[model samples]
Target: MNELAAQIGVEVEPDYRADESDPAQSRYVFSYTVTVHNRSTREIQLLSRYWKITQGNGKVQEVRGNGVVGKQPAIAAGHSFRYTSRAVLASPVGVMQGSYGCTDLASQEAFEVTIEPFRLATPNQVH
Candidate 1:
């Protein structure tokens, strides 16, 4: 779809910590920064988003919401927008993949911009 030709880039950072109040439950948090470029000739509005998160134990969670962090961004042709968000999982490893629902302002046509999969790892991954 020409209307959905925009490019998306995602960067992820992982943070792990043991809960002081409950040592049995460790907290694994992953922060993601997303940049979306409007490569099409028309301006577009990001209306919604869909996310699929997979944990270390093969459990997958799907998240769908209206706008990111409560704000809908409109990008004109040749422009881009960036957002940062965090996801918390119970395991030290996981991956996230999804898409952004976008609409062309001129024609009001809807399309989806795909988000590439990114990894979340612990400190051990550095070795």
Candidate 2:
């Protein structure tokens, strides 16, 4: 419910796991669940994903992949696809933003669904 673009809806929820993190080594683990909703009239298939991760120290990592969680799901109009993924950062706080490439099933037209920036922070960090 955070952002919607190109007739697609993107929601990102992040959770910080203290049990899996080691602050002394500067390793922070966060799990994020993403939901991609098809808001358009045309049916769409999620083809790929593109992400840009920024660490607290200004480090950036670009990730491009064929599909999410090893699946290319075809979402019907008004339906949605949801998946969870994990990220490891060298800092207590960071950011992630990206887009999903989708194809219109009927017309075979390709378009990008924008995902707004979301924060990855430990429980103690202030917003």
Using lDDT, give the best candidate's number. 2
Model 1 residue 34 distance off true place after TM-score fit, in angstroms = 0.8
TM-scores for candidates 1 onward, in order: 0.82, 0.93
Maximum-TM-score candidate: 2
Clashing pairs in 1: none
lDDT tens digits by residue: candidate 1, 47-109: 999999998878899999999989998999878788878888777788889888888888898
Error of 1 at 71 (Å): 0.8
What shift in Å separates residue 38 of candidate 1 from its native position after superposition? 1.3
**Which regions of candidate 2 are displaced past 4 Å?**
1-5
Which parts of model 1 are misplaced by more than 4 Å? 1-3, 6-24
Which 10-residue window of candidate 1 scores lowest in summed lDDT? 14-23
